[model samples]
Each structure stands twice: as structure tokens, then as C-alpha cells.
Target: METSDQNAAVDALKDPEAFSVIIDRYRYQLSRYIQRLGAFDSDTTKDLLQESFIKVYLNLNDYKPSLSFSSWIYRITHNEVMMHFRYMRNRAQAFASEDALTLFESIPDELDIAVESDARLRSMHIAKALQRLKPEYREILVLRFFEGKSYDEISDILEMAPGTVATYIARGKMALGKVLQEMNITSV
Candidate 1:
């Protein structure tokens, strides 16, 4: 991620393209986070990323300018994502429930690996594996994978104990690996 200097903050809020630079900087990092959670809405994920940057831009005036930009931005993104999930669940009569939406959107992202040759095939394997996971397991995986946050950070975000976070991440990963094995696809 580009260091959020004072000037960059100003530019980002004022110009959409300027915000793109911030996205370009954190795109992979954040996507990895989202992908872990079984989220694969390319546009929505990107929208969340952009929203994080926009919040940063809009709230630059409130920033103390003494904290790490990484933590600040990620904290916002985390909250936003949670709210997004909740919002989609209750609002808009398109889906039966959040579970249904997760069933559809999250699978595609589960297999989004940065690999060479037969990417589509690998993605299929990935998606299949993800579908087998329980939601609790799935959520932890996505938090770690997409956000790249540490155990403590995740604990704080989820308001769970650190040990709980560890258990979830471990269980989720094991479940993912097992799912991959069942599909005869080597886990990435």
C-alpha cells in the first residue's frame, strides 16, 4: 500500500482516479482478505475496497496523522464488510437470505488463486472445496486470507477471544484442506 501522505489523502478524496492509486496499492492485499472469506463479487469487493479508500479520504480531516494507515484503513474495511453482509441479508428482496447469497458469491472467490496454467480448472476445484465448509469456518478463512490480519487483530474484529480466533482459523484451514483432498485437487 502506498504510504498515505497528507497530499495523497487530499488527492484521493478529490479525484476518483487518485483513489484508484490507493486501490492499486492494496488491491491484492485486500482481495486476498475477501477471497479468504469466500467472497467473490469482483465488483462488490472492489466497491468495498474503494469505499474504504473513500472513507479514508473523507475522514482525512479527522485522522490524527499519527497512526499507521494500514491499521486504520483495514479497520474501516473490516467494519464495512461486516455491515455489507448484514445489509445484503435484510435488504433488497433478491435473495432468500444471506446464506443463499454467500452460497453463490463466496464460492467463486474461494478458488481465486494466483496461479499459472489451468487457472479456470483450479478455480473450479477451489470453489467446490469452499462449498463444503461450514459458515464459521468459511468466515475465519476469509478474514485471514483477505485481510491478512493477525490473530489478535481478527480476535478484536470478531470480538472473539484470541484462542477462539486461532481455533476457527485452524479448523477452517483444515476443513478447506480436507475439502480439497476430497476433490483430488492439491490445496494451494
Candidate 2:
């Protein structure tokens, strides 16, 4: 059977070398997540990821099996990105064009919108619309849709109640739809 993330955590506590398994498993997902959260540049994303991993390694002793390890790691990564934003004193930026395309592709089904012929232009509009959303809404949308996190997982990561996560997702979708409408990207 494949080792569960919880088991990996337990093993990593015993042998530090086992920690690499956890890092390897989470690196790509978390890196993409960091980018989605607004670390636009590769260097900044890599640095934040390194710092987050280090924090994760240091705090391995605190890993509670009751919470999925994925949630815990994501919580740590999310905090790191937020801290970076606070330190920089800047609002989160728009997704890179490629990421905007990916994000837009996943959104049409949810928004009940038909994929338009000019996907590039639509994607740019979507990216701009996403940037206009409140930070809480945008973060929840990214976690729920872009990162494919469940309500329970998002709750654990954001330290919010599951109901709040659901609420944010609903409101975020509505707000995103409104913004898209303002941009004249109507549903068909």
C-alpha cells in the first residue's frame, strides 16, 4: 500500500531523511499554490517555499494526525505568503498570463459561462476580475478551485470554520461573476 501523508510525518519524526518524502510530495502543488496566492516571480516563490518548508521541518513535532498533513502544510505555506505580502506592503497581483488561462479554464463551468472564441482575451479579463475581488474571497476561490482543496481542508488551512469556507466560496463566485459581467463577459 502507498504510505499515507500522516505515516510519512510519523516516519519523518523518527528519521529526518524521511522528511524529504514529504517535501517531494508537496513541493509542486505548494509551489503552484504559492504562485496562485500572489508570489508572481519564480525567485520569490522559491524563496517563500524554502522558508515554508523549513518551518514545516522545524514544526514536524507539532504535526497532529487529527488534521491531514496536507492541510497543515498548506496552512503554513499560506501564512508565509501572507507575511510576505504584509512585509512588502503591497496588494496581491494578477496571475501570470499562463496561470490566468488555467484559472479561467476551470472557472467557466462554475460560472455557467460558455468558453468564448477568444480565450486569451477572456482569460485576461478573468485575471483582472480576480484581482478586483476582496482578498478573502480571492484566497478562498483560489484554494477551493485553483488548488482543489475541500471545504474541510480549506477550513483547516485558513483556520476558518467549514461553514465560513463555504460561504466565502459562494460569495467569491458571485463577486467574480459580477466582475466578469462588468467586463462584458456574459454567460450564454
Candidate 3:
């Protein structure tokens, strides 16, 4: 079977219809990322997705095929989320949506089946820890672990050096551990 063009940006620019393919590929994942990062309402999330896609379309010429297309789209979505965060800066803490919780559960873990019943508790602990983190740390960890992006991909998405991405992940994990410890979430 023939493969689709890997340079989606160029294809999308030349044929506007091709942009929908990018949207179709990224919309759901992008929505999940926005929800996890900012916990925006559905209306707001939809609006952000629209705006982000529009920007992606407009900026197609700027994309470089040397980088992963996934990373480029994620970087756009990440900026949109941060822009919304700035707009809603006065708001209080936003809880994770059910979808976010489901996504977290979908990731494989090393815990034994005996701990299956305790998953809810662990999820809550993690959610709280994530909320306590600074946006930079939280975002880096989310992109790496939740979205399954590599350090190089994250560096592309976040526009940081690879070493900086590693540092943030390490620091984010330490911060998460500290938060969990304070909440008495010690392991057996």
C-alpha cells in the first residue's frame, strides 16, 4: 500500500481540503491535551481548537518537515491552551474532566492486579499533584508521559533544548513526588 505524504504542511497549504486530514488526525488528541492542561469547558475547548487550527493553516509555510508534524501541531495547541490560561487567569482551580481521568487510566502501569481497586485513589493523588505544579513543569510532564512524546519531540513542541526538556521532566517528577508525599500517598 502507498503511504500518505509525510510533509502534511506543504500538502495542506497547496490543497486546502488536505487541511481537514490534519484536523481529523489531531482534533481529538488536541482536545484532550487542552482539557488536561487547562480544564476548559467544551465551548472554550472548541473555540481554542478552531483558533489553533486556523493558525496552523495560516502558518503552514512556516513548518519544517525535518520536525515531526505531530510535534508542530502540538506546539500550536499548547500555545492556544496557554493563551486561554492567560485570558482566564483569575479563575480558580479546574478539576480534571472524566475524559482526562480515563486517559490517565489508559496508560499502562507497573502496579499489580491486586492494586486495581486502588487505582482511583492513585488517580486522585496524581491529579492533585499535577494541579499543584507550575505550568512549565506540568506541561512538560503531560507532553512526555500523557501524550507519549519523546524528549526531542517535546523540545520541538516546547521550543527548548533537549537537555532542558530532560531537566524539566526530572524536576517535574520530583515536584510531583513531593506533592504526593505531603498528601500521605506513600507506597507500601
Candidate 4:
């Protein structure tokens, strides 16, 4: 059986238009991932997305189908996002974007709230709590929970060992739980 994106990568190499298919498949996911990494502005996020796709396309041959394609692409995206942070680090402004809240919106509410009037408020609180996390902790949480990547997949994406990924997820969950607790938000 072909790896998830292996065939697409092959076709993309032969036809430039085929690359668009891959872009369409991953654009939203990559956009969200980029935002999670600290990009908030549409312009900067768009630029990084384009740059990431270009890099992926150019490096298609280097991709090993034996590995998870999702991880490989995320690695590229992660690198681009990190570069953005490095560039913006000197500007003295923290990345505080409401776009991150949209990620929570994608998650289905466990129960319809007929009584609680503060669902949005709670979401904002969670978003702020997430932002308070160190980038590594936040990234691991996002990948494991939001992106739904397996430990080995996250390992490949972050270029760490699987054991390292597990350790990060464990520690990240604890850190996130602590932050939520500080905000009086019950752990879900």
C-alpha cells in the first residue's frame, strides 16, 4: 500500500499542477499549524504557507515514502514557522492572535450548552492558557491532540525520537493542565 501522500508527491514531481492538489489538501491544516507556532497575521501566515509548499515541492525527491508524509511536511512547516519566530523575536511584540481560538472552534463541543452563557468566554480563556505555554509544550499538545498525530509521527515531524515525543506529550499535558487549572478551567 502506498503511504498517504507518496503518490501525490510522485505525481507532483511530474506535473506542476499536481502540486496544487497537495496544497489544497494541506492548506488549512498547515495554516492552523503555522498559527499555533506564533503567526497571527494573514499576510505573514500566507507567505509562510507559500514558502513551505515551495520548499516541499522542491524537496519532493528527498521525501522517503517509507516514512509518514504528514510528518515530513509538518517538519517543513515547523521549520518555516520557527524562522518566522526568529525573525519577529527582535521586534519586542509577542504573538497574540485570536486566530488560535478558531482551532478550538473546530473541536466539537462535548455538550450543547443550554444553560452556560460563557462558552465563548471559556474558549478564549483556554486559548490564552494555551498561549501562555512554552512553544515546545504548545507544539507537542497541538500535534498530539489537535493534529491527532501518533507518537512516531510526531517524532518524525519534530525530528525527535518516539520516546522523546512521548515525554514531551506527557510533560506538555501536565503543563497545559496546570495552566488551565490556574485559569480555573477544568481539564477536558
**Global lDDT of each candidate:** 0.60, 0.82, 0.74, 0.74
Whichever of 1 and 3 has more TM-score, that candidate is 3
Residue 32, candidate 3: C-alpha displacement in angstroms: 1.3
Worst 10 residues of 4 by lDDT: 107-116
Tens-place lDDT per residue, model 1, 6-39, is 5566786677567666667766776556444444
- Per-residue alpha-carbon lDDT of model 4 for 10-65, expressed as tens digits? 99999998888789989999998877656367788899999999999999999997
For model 2, where is the 10-residue window of minimal lDDT?
A: 106-115
Off by over 4 Å in 4: 1-4, 90-98, 106-118
Say what the RMSD of model 1 is: 7.4
**What value of lDDT does candidate 3 attain over all alpha carbons?**
0.74
- Against the hidden true structure, what lDDT does model 4 obtain? 0.74
Tens digits of lDDT, candidate 2, 1-188: 87889888889889999989889999999988887777367788899999999999899889898898899999999998989989988757756677666545556355455535687877667667767888799789888877888899999999999998998999898888787777777663
Model number with the top lDDT: 2
Clashing pairs in 1: 32-145, 32-146, 33-145, 33-146, 33-147, 34-146, 36-142, 37-142, 38-106
**Could you list the CA RMSD of all candidates, in the order they appear?**
7.4, 2.2, 3.2, 4.3
